[model samples]
Target: MNLTVLRKDFLAGVVVFLVALPLSLGIAQACDLPAFAGLLSGVIGGVVVTLFSPSRFAVSGPAAGLVTIVTGAVATLGSYSLVLLAIAIAGLLQAAFGLLRAGRWIGLIPDSVIQGMMVAIGLQLVLQQIPVFTGAETAAAGELFSPACLSVAAGAMLILLLWQQP
Candidate 1:
């Protein structure tokens, strides 16, 4: 392996770890799990991905997209152990899909659509952080465009634009 590539990957891994630490805790709380579980999940995910994942660039961590499903499953099952079983079964199913080469269908998506989806997801993440930026206790629906939120969002965008400059 090239030393420069290795160095860049190590730096990226550290950055991902830093970001994933708090995110994992937040995601676990969203799912009604203990904070320790989030930390453990992050660690275990890193180890498993490092050992087994086919792609070095694959990011493994808890995600906001799973929050509703996890919360609902916990509420219905009434036990974390059962939720873990469900997660294990889901993992097995995902592996089965991979083995079946189902992921090849993603190639059918147009590059433009995929890029647009990525931009949408990034915008959603930025919008979701507006309340935090504005120190709001809670953001109600339809209030994301309030002046304070917009100001913070604009400032954030400006900083990102400036930071990306050569």
Candidate 2:
């Protein structure tokens, strides 16, 4: 690649690395694991495999979007080693997709469908946050939207309204 293009790629990578740090830590915690795994994966994707990668300006790292899938895989596999095995398998699949140039299919996704998916994700986040915002003490209770929760939530709203001075 040209020197100017390489410099731009390096600059883009610095931006991505900063963003990836917090995202990976959050994802690792949510996945019930240490943050180092995410860092390790990022190092491999960024420095090691990056030499052979096609995307020059794209910085690679552990994505928070995979938290749900990684956590589910760990629960199903019942071991961290197995979770790593699954990750390896996923990498292979991703390589195969790249080899087949399946990335072209991303253009086929309709904007409406993508927007609907985003809206759905937002709703799910709100539902998940309710318990935390209401000071939920027990995750074992399995009641995300209980009467007590709603009452506590209402009380918090009232407090916010009364405390607002500006």
Candidate 3:
């Protein structure tokens, strides 16, 4: 690579580092884990995967999507270290997926359908949590919005909606 490109990449990396710190911390807090764990995952994704990942532009890190996966695994396995073992298994599965190019069909999805799905996901987040805010949390506490925590979560939610409007 050219020196100019390398210099720009270094500068961009510094910015990405700064931008990632708080986002990673917030994700850890939401998932009920120590912030250092999130930082460790970021470090592993940045260093370990860089050695072998074929795609140069793909973002790999402690993802929010893995919240359910990690939590479920923890509940099943009863330890976070065991969750790391599961992650290794998942990493192998993902590497196989990349090698097989299994995501080749992702581009074939209709834009309208994809857009509709995105809209549905957004609405689902609000609707699913509404029951909690209305005081239905007695059903499932650790769920997206627990019945017990619903009353507590309502104010934060109202603020979110109000913040969105203006």
Candidate 4:
């Protein structure tokens, strides 16, 4: 492998680690679990995926997308142990699907649909961070278009534009 490419990948990994570390803690808190659980999950996920996953570039970390599902599962089951059991079963099912080559079916999805989903997820993340950008305690409908929020929104857009330049 080229040293330049290796260096770039290493830098990217560092960035990912920095971002994933706090996110893992936040995700665990959202699911009403101790912060250490999130750290442990991240470590295990990294080790397992790195060793077994076919895709070398696949990312394995605490996902913001699963926060609601985890919270709901914990609430419905009334115990963390039940949620752990459910996760283990789900993982086993996924392994079975992988062995069956079910993952290849995902390649059948159209690029446009996948791009649209990515855009939607990006928008959702920005919407969720509106309150933080506006220095508000909560992101209420009425507060969404306030002067502070608008200014922050404009600044964020500017930063995104600048960051996207070659």
Candidate 5:
């Protein structure tokens, strides 16, 4: 309500947009979907989820964890339209589960299983991004690695490492 609160909220929104925009675009690229699809989904998901969620600090956006499954779904379904239909059905099912208060059962899941799933997701993301990192499409058969691509990747990694330092 106050000016300070408004400023803080605006800053938070900008930070979230900066992080979420590229994540959404990368997820769409990973799934072999159009870039616009990712951008639209990210915006809609963030707005709708933030508006309807009970939690005041919920950050709902396109999930990086779903990249592998989404890619497989698009491939298997052989159409993005079919994948979209499936996603709609899944959303309905999720809403039904929420209404039924099935979230209470989530505590039954083991921590090790959850950790393993996280590790798997991380591995899948790295593996999926390999081609993009190497510029696989542009490189010839005898020359797979591009110096520029490798330099960019190394710089990105260094930045990520430095980001956690302080």
Candidate 6:
């Protein structure tokens, strides 16, 4: 409510945007969708979701786990637009469930089951990126292995690992 609080919130938002931008793009790439789709989704999550959120500090955004499900949906639907329609329908269903207070049922599931699902999602996400990281794009017509791409990926990973040191 105060000016200092507002400034701190703004700074936090800037940090979130910096982190979410590349993450959104990567998720879009993993989903086989254009970069703009990711940016648009991030913007909607940050802006539209914020507008409707009951908590002032709540932040919402896309997750990497969605890549597998979305990729499969696009493949099965055979059209990006159809997949988007399906997503919209799913969102409506989710909202309806939320209105009905269905989230309380989530506690019925065991914590181990939830953790196992998250582990599976994380594993799938890593496996999906293996081809890109290895430069073995299945849809590509040219070289199977690209040293240039590999080097860039390796360099990025090295930098990330170094940055995480305490």
Best by lDDT: 5
Candidate 3 vs candidate 4, lDDT winner: 4
Per-residue CA lDDT of model 2 for 22-140, tens digit only, reads 87776676677888977776677667557886685455677544666677788899999989988889879998999999999998999999898777656765665566666564434
lDDT of 4 by residue, 1-166 (tens): 9999999999999998999899998889767888998998988998899899889788888788677678789999999889999999999999999889899899999999999977776676666566666757555665654567668778988999889855
lDDT of 3 by residue, 11-78 (tens): 98888888777767756654556889788778877887778767887555655555555656777898
Tens-digit per-residue lDDT, 19-105, candidate 6: 999999988988889999999999987887888889967878888888889999989999989999998999899999989999999
Ranking by lDDT: 5, 6, 4, 1, 2, 3
What lDDT does each candidate get?
0.82, 0.75, 0.71, 0.83, 0.91, 0.88
Which has the higher TM-score value, candidate number 1 or candidate number 3? 1
What TM-score fits each model? 0.61, 0.61, 0.57, 0.62, 0.93, 0.87
The runs of at least 3 residues in candidate 6 whose Cα sits more than 4 Å from the true structure, single-residue gaps closed, are 138-144
Question: How well does model 5 score by local distance difference test?
Answer: 0.91
lDDT of 1 by residue, 1-166 (tens): 9999999988998999899999999889767899998899889988888798889577888777666678789999999999999999998998899899999899999999989877765676666555666646445665644566667767987999889855
Q: List the candidate numbers ranked by TM-score, top first.
A: 5, 6, 4, 1, 2, 3
Error in Å for residue 143 of model 3:
23
Locate the minimum summed-lDDT window of 10 residues in model 2: 137-146
lDDT of the structure predicted as candidate 3: 0.71
Local error of candidate 4 at 139, Å? 16
Quote the positional error of residue 123 for candidate 6 in Å: 1.6
Show pairs that collide, candidate 5.
Answer: none
| Worst window of 10 by summed lDDT in candidate 1 | 137-146
